[model samples]
Target: MTGWLLAAVALAVGFWSYGWQGGVLALSVIVFWLLLQFSRAMRAMRRASESPVGRLRNAVMFQSRLKRGMTMLQIVGQTRSLGQRRPELGDDVWTWTDDGGVGVTLHFERGQLARWTLDRPADGPAEAPVDAPPAPAAPPPAA
Candidate 1:
Protein backbone atom coordinates (compact mmCIF):
# COMPACT_ATOMS: atom_id res chain seq x y z
CA MET A 1 0.00 0.00 0.00
CA THR A 2 0.94 3.68 -0.16
CA GLY A 3 1.76 3.75 3.52
CA TRP A 4 4.26 0.94 3.14
CA LEU A 5 5.87 2.67 0.16
CA LEU A 6 6.17 5.93 2.06
CA ALA A 7 7.70 4.18 5.03
CA ALA A 8 10.19 2.49 2.79
CA VAL A 9 11.09 5.79 1.14
CA ALA A 10 11.56 7.41 4.53
CA LEU A 11 13.89 4.62 5.68
CA ALA A 12 15.93 4.82 2.48
CA VAL A 13 16.27 8.57 2.72
CA GLY A 14 17.21 8.39 6.39
CA PHE A 15 19.94 5.82 5.83
CA TRP A 16 21.26 7.60 2.74
CA SER A 17 21.46 10.94 4.58
CA TYR A 18 22.86 9.98 8.00
CA GLY A 19 23.60 6.23 8.24
CA TRP A 20 22.13 3.84 10.88
CA GLN A 21 21.24 6.50 13.41
CA GLY A 22 19.03 8.30 10.89
CA GLY A 23 17.41 4.99 9.90
CA VAL A 24 16.67 4.25 13.58
CA LEU A 25 15.19 7.73 14.03
CA ALA A 26 13.01 7.35 10.94
CA LEU A 27 11.78 3.93 12.10
CA SER A 28 10.93 5.32 15.52
CA VAL A 29 9.00 8.17 13.99
CA ILE A 30 7.09 5.81 11.72
CA VAL A 31 6.18 3.52 14.61
CA PHE A 32 5.01 6.48 16.67
CA TRP A 33 2.81 7.72 13.87
CA LEU A 34 1.29 4.26 13.42
CA LEU A 35 0.61 4.01 17.13
CA LEU A 36 -1.15 7.38 17.09
CA GLN A 37 -3.35 6.25 14.24
CA PHE A 38 -4.20 3.02 16.04
CA SER A 39 -5.03 4.90 19.22
CA ARG A 40 -7.32 7.25 17.36
CA ALA A 41 -9.15 4.37 15.72
CA MET A 42 -9.63 2.62 19.05
CA ARG A 43 -11.09 5.76 20.55
CA ALA A 44 -13.57 6.13 17.74
CA MET A 45 -14.64 2.51 18.10
CA ARG A 46 -15.10 2.86 21.83
CA ARG A 47 -17.35 5.87 21.36
CA ALA A 48 -19.32 4.11 18.69
CA SER A 49 -19.92 1.07 20.88
CA GLU A 50 -21.74 3.18 23.46
CA SER A 51 -24.60 3.66 20.97
CA PRO A 52 -27.07 1.12 19.69
CA VAL A 53 -26.32 -0.80 16.57
CA GLY A 54 -27.35 0.90 13.33
CA ARG A 55 -28.91 3.73 15.24
CA LEU A 56 -27.95 7.40 15.02
CA ARG A 57 -29.42 10.62 16.39
CA ASN A 58 -30.45 12.10 13.04
CA ALA A 59 -30.07 10.24 9.79
CA VAL A 60 -30.97 13.29 7.73
CA MET A 61 -28.16 15.29 9.25
CA PHE A 62 -25.78 12.42 8.74
CA GLN A 63 -26.75 12.17 5.09
CA SER A 64 -26.21 15.88 4.63
CA ARG A 65 -22.73 15.63 6.11
CA LEU A 66 -21.72 12.81 3.79
CA LYS A 67 -19.40 13.42 0.88
CA ARG A 68 -18.19 11.12 -1.85
CA GLY A 69 -15.01 9.14 -1.29
CA MET A 70 -15.31 9.17 2.51
CA THR A 71 -13.85 6.09 4.18
CA MET A 72 -15.94 3.71 6.29
CA LEU A 73 -14.16 4.81 9.45
CA GLN A 74 -15.16 8.42 8.85
CA ILE A 75 -18.78 7.43 8.39
CA VAL A 76 -18.68 5.29 11.54
CA GLY A 77 -17.24 8.22 13.45
CA GLN A 78 -20.08 10.43 12.29
CA THR A 79 -22.81 7.89 12.95
CA ARG A 80 -21.27 6.89 16.29
CA SER A 81 -22.03 3.24 15.50
CA LEU A 82 -21.05 0.69 13.02
CA GLY A 83 -23.55 0.28 10.18
CA GLN A 84 -25.49 -2.91 9.55
CA ARG A 85 -23.77 -4.75 6.78
CA ARG A 86 -26.05 -5.76 3.89
CA PRO A 87 -24.07 -8.45 2.19
CA GLU A 88 -27.16 -9.63 0.34
CA LEU A 89 -27.08 -6.44 -1.65
CA GLY A 90 -23.31 -6.28 -2.14
CA ASP A 91 -20.06 -6.81 -0.38
CA ASP A 92 -19.74 -3.14 0.55
CA VAL A 93 -23.34 -2.14 1.25
CA TRP A 94 -24.14 -0.87 4.74
CA THR A 95 -27.19 0.68 6.33
CA TRP A 96 -27.79 2.91 9.32
CA THR A 97 -31.25 3.55 10.71
CA ASP A 98 -32.65 6.18 13.01
CA ASP A 99 -35.33 6.08 15.68
CA GLY A 100 -37.80 7.50 13.14
CA GLY A 101 -37.33 4.35 11.02
CA VAL A 102 -35.48 6.32 8.41
CA GLY A 103 -32.50 4.47 6.99
CA VAL A 104 -29.44 5.45 5.03
CA THR A 105 -27.99 2.84 2.73
CA LEU A 106 -24.43 3.32 1.65
CA HIS A 107 -22.46 1.61 -1.04
CA PHE A 108 -18.71 1.55 -0.96
CA GLU A 109 -16.32 0.62 -3.71
CA ARG A 110 -12.71 -0.17 -3.11
CA GLY A 111 -13.07 0.91 0.55
CA GLN A 112 -14.41 4.38 -0.26
CA LEU A 113 -17.97 5.64 -0.33
CA ALA A 114 -19.34 5.49 -3.84
CA ARG A 115 -22.99 6.40 -3.27
CA TRP A 116 -25.72 6.43 -0.66
CA THR A 117 -29.49 6.60 -0.44
CA LEU A 118 -31.82 7.69 2.34
CA ASP A 119 -35.01 5.74 2.99
CA ARG A 120 -37.71 7.62 4.82
CA PRO A 121 -41.12 6.30 5.81
CA ALA A 122 -43.95 7.97 3.93
CA ASP A 123 -45.61 10.84 5.79
CA GLY A 124 -48.92 12.78 5.64
CA PRO A 125 -52.46 11.49 5.37
CA ALA A 126 -52.95 8.04 4.01
CA GLU A 127 -54.16 7.67 0.44
CA ALA A 128 -56.57 5.15 -1.13
CA PRO A 129 -55.19 1.71 -1.71
CA VAL A 130 -53.90 0.85 -5.17
CA ASP A 131 -56.82 -1.54 -5.89
CA ALA A 132 -59.48 1.05 -5.03
CA PRO A 133 -61.27 2.72 -7.90
CA PRO A 134 -60.95 6.45 -8.49
CA ALA A 135 -63.74 8.55 -7.01
CA PRO A 136 -65.99 10.37 -9.49
CA ALA A 137 -65.58 14.14 -9.64
CA ALA A 138 -68.26 16.26 -8.00
CA PRO A 139 -70.66 18.11 -10.31
CA PRO A 140 -70.11 21.87 -10.65
CA PRO A 141 -72.66 24.34 -9.19
CA ALA A 142 -75.02 26.06 -11.65
CA ALA A 143 -73.82 29.46 -12.87
Candidate 2:
Protein backbone atom coordinates (compact mmCIF):
# COMPACT_ATOMS: atom_id res chain seq x y z
CA MET A 1 0.00 0.00 0.00
CA THR A 2 2.83 2.39 0.85
CA GLY A 3 4.48 1.52 -2.44
CA TRP A 4 1.20 2.05 -4.25
CA LEU A 5 0.74 5.47 -2.70
CA LEU A 6 4.21 6.52 -3.66
CA ALA A 7 3.71 5.28 -7.20
CA ALA A 8 0.38 7.10 -7.46
CA VAL A 9 1.95 10.35 -6.40
CA ALA A 10 4.75 9.81 -8.87
CA LEU A 11 2.22 9.10 -11.63
CA ALA A 12 0.40 12.33 -10.89
CA VAL A 13 3.63 14.23 -11.11
CA GLY A 14 4.47 12.48 -14.36
CA PHE A 15 1.10 13.43 -15.78
CA TRP A 16 1.76 17.02 -14.86
CA SER A 17 5.06 17.18 -16.81
CA TYR A 18 5.99 14.00 -18.74
CA GLY A 19 2.69 13.71 -20.68
CA TRP A 20 -0.03 11.00 -21.00
CA GLN A 21 2.33 8.14 -21.92
CA GLY A 22 4.37 8.50 -18.73
CA GLY A 23 1.19 8.67 -16.66
CA VAL A 24 -0.08 5.48 -18.36
CA LEU A 25 3.17 3.67 -17.61
CA ALA A 26 2.92 4.55 -13.93
CA LEU A 27 -0.75 3.45 -13.89
CA SER A 28 0.24 0.07 -15.36
CA VAL A 29 2.77 -0.47 -12.59
CA ILE A 30 0.12 0.28 -9.97
CA VAL A 31 -2.29 -2.14 -11.64
CA PHE A 32 0.33 -4.91 -11.63
CA TRP A 33 1.01 -4.27 -7.95
CA LEU A 34 -2.70 -4.59 -7.13
CA LEU A 35 -2.93 -7.88 -9.01
CA LEU A 36 0.09 -9.21 -7.14
CA GLN A 37 -1.48 -8.30 -3.83
CA PHE A 38 -4.72 -10.09 -4.76
CA SER A 39 -2.88 -13.27 -5.78
CA ARG A 40 -0.96 -13.31 -2.48
CA ALA A 41 -4.17 -13.01 -0.49
CA MET A 42 -5.80 -15.90 -2.41
CA ARG A 43 -2.77 -18.11 -1.81
CA ALA A 44 -2.86 -17.31 1.91
CA MET A 45 -6.51 -18.37 2.11
CA ARG A 46 -5.85 -21.66 0.31
CA ARG A 47 -3.07 -22.60 2.76
CA ALA A 48 -4.65 -20.97 5.82
CA SER A 49 -5.36 -23.97 8.06
CA GLU A 50 -4.54 -27.66 8.27
CA SER A 51 -6.78 -28.17 11.30
CA PRO A 52 -10.41 -27.09 11.66
CA VAL A 53 -10.26 -27.38 15.45
CA GLY A 54 -7.68 -24.63 15.58
CA ARG A 55 -9.63 -22.70 12.97
CA LEU A 56 -12.76 -23.02 15.09
CA ARG A 57 -10.83 -21.56 18.01
CA ASN A 58 -9.89 -18.54 15.91
CA ALA A 59 -13.41 -18.11 14.47
CA VAL A 60 -15.41 -18.66 17.69
CA MET A 61 -13.93 -20.04 20.90
CA PHE A 62 -15.77 -23.02 22.41
CA GLN A 63 -16.40 -23.73 26.09
CA SER A 64 -14.78 -27.17 25.75
CA ARG A 65 -13.56 -28.64 22.45
CA LEU A 66 -15.53 -29.67 19.38
CA LYS A 67 -16.47 -33.34 18.93
CA ARG A 68 -17.51 -35.62 16.12
CA GLY A 69 -20.93 -35.03 14.47
CA MET A 70 -20.87 -31.37 15.50
CA THR A 71 -22.73 -28.97 13.24
CA MET A 72 -22.42 -25.22 12.90
CA LEU A 73 -23.04 -22.51 10.30
CA GLN A 74 -19.38 -21.57 10.31
CA ILE A 75 -18.21 -25.21 10.03
CA VAL A 76 -15.01 -24.14 11.77
CA GLY A 77 -14.84 -21.19 9.37
CA GLN A 78 -11.54 -22.18 7.85
CA THR A 79 -10.31 -20.10 4.91
CA ARG A 80 -10.19 -23.10 2.51
CA SER A 81 -13.32 -24.17 0.65
CA LEU A 82 -14.77 -27.00 2.80
CA GLY A 83 -17.86 -27.80 0.73
CA GLN A 84 -17.30 -31.18 -0.95
CA ARG A 85 -20.71 -32.24 -2.17
CA ARG A 86 -21.56 -35.97 -2.60
CA PRO A 87 -25.19 -36.56 -3.48
CA GLU A 88 -24.72 -40.24 -4.37
CA LEU A 89 -24.25 -41.32 -0.75
CA GLY A 90 -26.72 -38.76 0.59
CA ASP A 91 -28.11 -35.38 -0.27
CA ASP A 92 -26.09 -32.27 0.48
CA VAL A 93 -23.17 -34.16 2.04
CA TRP A 94 -19.80 -32.44 1.98
CA THR A 95 -16.28 -33.33 3.11
CA TRP A 96 -13.36 -31.17 4.18
CA THR A 97 -9.96 -32.64 4.90
CA ASP A 98 -6.79 -30.77 5.75
CA ASP A 99 -3.18 -31.64 4.97
CA GLY A 100 -2.80 -33.22 8.42
CA GLY A 101 -5.38 -35.99 7.69
CA VAL A 102 -7.87 -34.37 10.08
CA GLY A 103 -11.16 -34.36 8.18
CA VAL A 104 -14.84 -33.64 8.67
CA THR A 105 -17.77 -34.91 6.65
CA LEU A 106 -20.73 -32.57 6.90
CA HIS A 107 -24.36 -33.21 6.03
CA PHE A 108 -26.19 -30.08 4.95
CA GLU A 109 -29.92 -29.57 4.84
CA ARG A 110 -29.95 -26.06 3.48
CA GLY A 111 -26.70 -24.11 3.44
CA GLN A 112 -25.78 -24.96 7.03
CA LEU A 113 -23.82 -27.89 8.39
CA ALA A 114 -26.52 -30.04 9.98
CA ARG A 115 -24.41 -33.10 10.84
CA TRP A 116 -20.69 -33.90 10.64
CA THR A 117 -18.06 -36.50 11.47
CA LEU A 118 -14.52 -35.61 12.46
CA ASP A 119 -11.92 -38.30 11.70
CA ARG A 120 -8.59 -37.77 13.40
CA PRO A 121 -6.96 -40.78 14.99
CA ALA A 122 -3.75 -40.50 16.94
CA ASP A 123 -2.18 -43.89 16.24
CA GLY A 124 -4.90 -45.83 14.47
CA PRO A 125 -5.05 -46.64 10.78
CA ALA A 126 -5.96 -43.90 8.27
CA GLU A 127 -8.95 -45.86 6.93
CA ALA A 128 -11.97 -46.21 9.16
CA PRO A 129 -14.51 -49.08 9.28
CA VAL A 130 -15.74 -50.63 6.03
CA ASP A 131 -19.40 -49.99 6.84
CA ALA A 132 -18.75 -46.33 7.55
CA PRO A 133 -16.94 -44.82 4.59
CA PRO A 134 -14.17 -42.28 4.97
CA ALA A 135 -14.58 -38.71 3.79
CA PRO A 136 -15.44 -38.73 0.09
CA ALA A 137 -15.90 -36.06 -2.53
CA ALA A 138 -19.15 -34.11 -2.25
CA PRO A 139 -21.43 -33.71 -5.24
CA PRO A 140 -22.38 -30.44 -6.85
CA PRO A 141 -25.42 -28.45 -5.79
CA ALA A 142 -28.78 -29.30 -7.39
CA ALA A 143 -29.71 -27.26 -10.41
Candidate 3:
Protein backbone atom coordinates (compact mmCIF):
# COMPACT_ATOMS: atom_id res chain seq x y z
CA MET A 1 0.00 0.00 0.00
CA THR A 2 2.64 2.50 1.05
CA GLY A 3 4.92 1.12 -1.60
CA TRP A 4 2.28 1.71 -4.25
CA LEU A 5 1.77 5.28 -3.12
CA LEU A 6 5.43 6.00 -3.16
CA ALA A 7 5.76 4.39 -6.57
CA ALA A 8 2.87 6.47 -7.87
CA VAL A 9 4.58 9.60 -6.67
CA ALA A 10 7.82 8.55 -8.33
CA LEU A 11 5.98 7.78 -11.56
CA ALA A 12 4.34 11.14 -11.58
CA VAL A 13 7.63 12.88 -11.06
CA GLY A 14 9.39 10.75 -13.66
CA PHE A 15 6.65 11.43 -16.24
CA TRP A 16 6.96 15.14 -15.60
CA SER A 17 10.71 14.99 -16.13
CA TYR A 18 11.10 12.52 -19.03
CA GLY A 19 7.72 11.85 -20.62
CA TRP A 20 5.70 8.56 -20.58
CA GLN A 21 8.18 6.03 -21.99
CA GLY A 22 11.04 6.95 -19.70
CA GLY A 23 8.72 7.37 -16.76
CA VAL A 24 7.09 3.96 -17.22
CA LEU A 25 10.42 2.19 -17.46
CA ALA A 26 11.92 4.01 -14.51
CA LEU A 27 8.80 3.54 -12.43
CA SER A 28 8.67 -0.17 -13.23
CA VAL A 29 12.23 -0.67 -12.04
CA ILE A 30 11.69 1.35 -8.89
CA VAL A 31 8.48 -0.49 -8.01
CA PHE A 32 10.10 -3.85 -8.55
CA TRP A 33 13.00 -2.92 -6.27
CA LEU A 34 10.70 -1.58 -3.57
CA LEU A 35 8.56 -4.72 -3.56
CA LEU A 36 11.61 -6.93 -3.27
CA GLN A 37 12.97 -4.90 -0.38
CA PHE A 38 9.62 -4.81 1.41
CA SER A 39 9.15 -8.56 1.23
CA ARG A 40 12.63 -9.19 2.53
CA ALA A 41 12.13 -6.76 5.39
CA MET A 42 8.87 -8.45 6.39
CA ARG A 43 10.50 -11.87 6.47
CA ALA A 44 13.37 -10.57 8.55
CA MET A 45 11.02 -9.01 11.08
CA ARG A 46 9.12 -12.29 11.48
CA ARG A 47 12.27 -14.36 11.86
CA ALA A 48 13.79 -12.04 14.46
CA SER A 49 10.64 -12.33 16.56
CA GLU A 50 10.86 -16.13 16.57
CA SER A 51 14.61 -16.75 16.80
CA PRO A 52 15.23 -16.77 20.54
CA VAL A 53 12.69 -19.51 21.14
CA GLY A 54 13.92 -21.51 18.19
CA ARG A 55 17.52 -21.31 19.36
CA LEU A 56 16.61 -22.42 22.88
CA ARG A 57 14.73 -25.43 21.60
CA ASN A 58 17.50 -26.47 19.28
CA ALA A 59 20.11 -26.16 22.02
CA VAL A 60 18.01 -28.21 24.43
CA MET A 61 17.47 -30.93 21.84
CA PHE A 62 21.17 -31.14 21.07
CA GLN A 63 22.03 -31.39 24.73
CA SER A 64 19.52 -34.20 25.17
CA ARG A 65 21.08 -36.20 22.34
CA LEU A 66 24.51 -35.73 23.85
CA LYS A 67 23.37 -37.02 27.23
CA ARG A 68 21.91 -40.09 25.56
CA GLY A 69 25.31 -40.88 24.10
CA MET A 70 27.05 -41.29 27.49
CA THR A 71 28.06 -37.68 27.55
CA MET A 72 26.88 -36.70 31.01
CA LEU A 73 25.59 -33.22 30.39
CA GLN A 74 22.65 -30.91 30.79
CA ILE A 75 21.07 -28.23 28.69
CA VAL A 76 21.62 -25.89 31.64
CA GLY A 77 20.15 -22.93 29.85
CA GLN A 78 20.56 -20.59 26.93
CA THR A 79 20.72 -16.83 26.55
CA ARG A 80 20.45 -14.24 23.82
CA SER A 81 22.00 -11.08 25.17
CA LEU A 82 21.33 -8.34 22.69
CA GLY A 83 24.49 -7.54 20.79
CA GLN A 84 25.71 -4.00 20.65
CA ARG A 85 24.10 -3.87 17.23
CA ARG A 86 21.22 -5.64 15.53
CA PRO A 87 22.12 -8.71 13.51
CA GLU A 88 21.52 -8.85 9.81
CA LEU A 89 18.49 -10.60 8.34
CA GLY A 90 18.19 -14.35 9.04
CA ASP A 91 20.98 -14.39 11.63
CA ASP A 92 20.71 -15.71 15.21
CA VAL A 93 22.55 -17.65 17.87
CA TRP A 94 22.87 -21.44 17.59
CA THR A 95 24.28 -24.29 19.67
CA TRP A 96 25.19 -27.84 18.77
CA THR A 97 27.16 -30.85 19.95
CA ASP A 98 28.79 -33.69 18.04
CA ASP A 99 31.41 -36.42 18.37
CA GLY A 100 34.06 -33.80 17.89
CA GLY A 101 32.85 -31.42 20.58
CA VAL A 102 30.09 -29.19 21.96
CA GLY A 103 29.85 -25.59 20.86
CA VAL A 104 27.59 -22.54 20.89
CA THR A 105 27.77 -19.10 19.33
CA LEU A 106 25.97 -16.37 17.49
CA HIS A 107 25.23 -16.57 13.77
CA PHE A 108 25.31 -13.02 12.50
CA GLU A 109 25.56 -10.58 9.61
CA ARG A 110 28.87 -11.06 7.80
CA GLY A 111 30.00 -14.07 9.84
CA GLN A 112 29.53 -15.81 13.16
CA LEU A 113 30.44 -14.01 16.41
CA ALA A 114 29.71 -10.54 15.17
CA ARG A 115 29.33 -9.53 18.82
CA TRP A 116 31.08 -11.89 21.22
CA THR A 117 32.35 -15.46 21.40
CA LEU A 118 32.39 -17.78 24.39
CA ASP A 119 35.56 -19.77 24.96
CA ARG A 120 35.45 -23.34 23.66
CA PRO A 121 34.87 -26.02 26.31
CA ALA A 122 37.45 -28.68 27.09
CA ASP A 123 36.88 -32.27 28.30
CA GLY A 124 38.21 -31.63 31.83
CA PRO A 125 35.21 -30.03 33.55
CA ALA A 126 32.30 -27.81 32.68
CA GLU A 127 32.67 -24.13 33.48
CA ALA A 128 30.34 -22.35 35.90
CA PRO A 129 26.85 -23.43 34.92
CA VAL A 130 25.06 -20.63 33.16
CA ASP A 131 21.38 -21.04 32.48
CA ALA A 132 19.85 -19.34 29.52
CA PRO A 133 18.52 -15.95 30.54
CA PRO A 134 15.09 -14.71 29.64
CA ALA A 135 14.69 -12.91 26.35
CA PRO A 136 15.05 -9.16 26.46
CA ALA A 137 11.89 -7.09 26.55
CA ALA A 138 10.90 -5.34 23.38
CA PRO A 139 11.27 -1.58 23.46
CA PRO A 140 8.20 0.61 23.57
CA PRO A 141 7.26 2.26 20.30
CA ALA A 142 7.78 5.95 19.91
CA ALA A 143 4.69 8.14 20.06
Point to the candidate with the largest lDDT.
Answer: 1
**Residue pairs with clashing backbones, model 3:** 77-132, 78-132
Per-residue alpha-carbon lDDT of candidate 3 for residues 1-143, written as tens digits (9 for 90 to 100) = 67678877888888988899869887788978978877865655555455433233333334333321121011222222112222443344444333243344434333323332332446646555578676799999999
**How many pairs in model 1 have backbone atoms within 3 A of each other, for residues 3 or more apart or on separate chains, i.e. clashes?**
0
* Candidates 1 and 2 compared by lDDT, better number: 1
Expressed as tens digits, the lDDT of each residue in 14-112 for candidate 2 is 798779988998888888887997786556455544544333322112312434444433343343344555678597776655555565666766555
Off by over 4 Å in 3: 1-19, 53-119, 122-143
Once superposed on the true structure, which residue ranges of model 2 sit more than 4 Å away at CA? 49-143
TM-score per prediction, in order, is 0.83, 0.35, 0.31
Candidate 1: which stretches are off by over 4 Å? Answer: 123-143
Question: How many angstroms is residue 41 displaced in model 3 relative to the true structure, after the best TM-score fit?
Answer: 1.9
**Highest TM-score model number:** 1
Models sorted by TM-score, best on top: 1, 2, 3
Candidate 2: residue 79 lDDT (0-100): 31
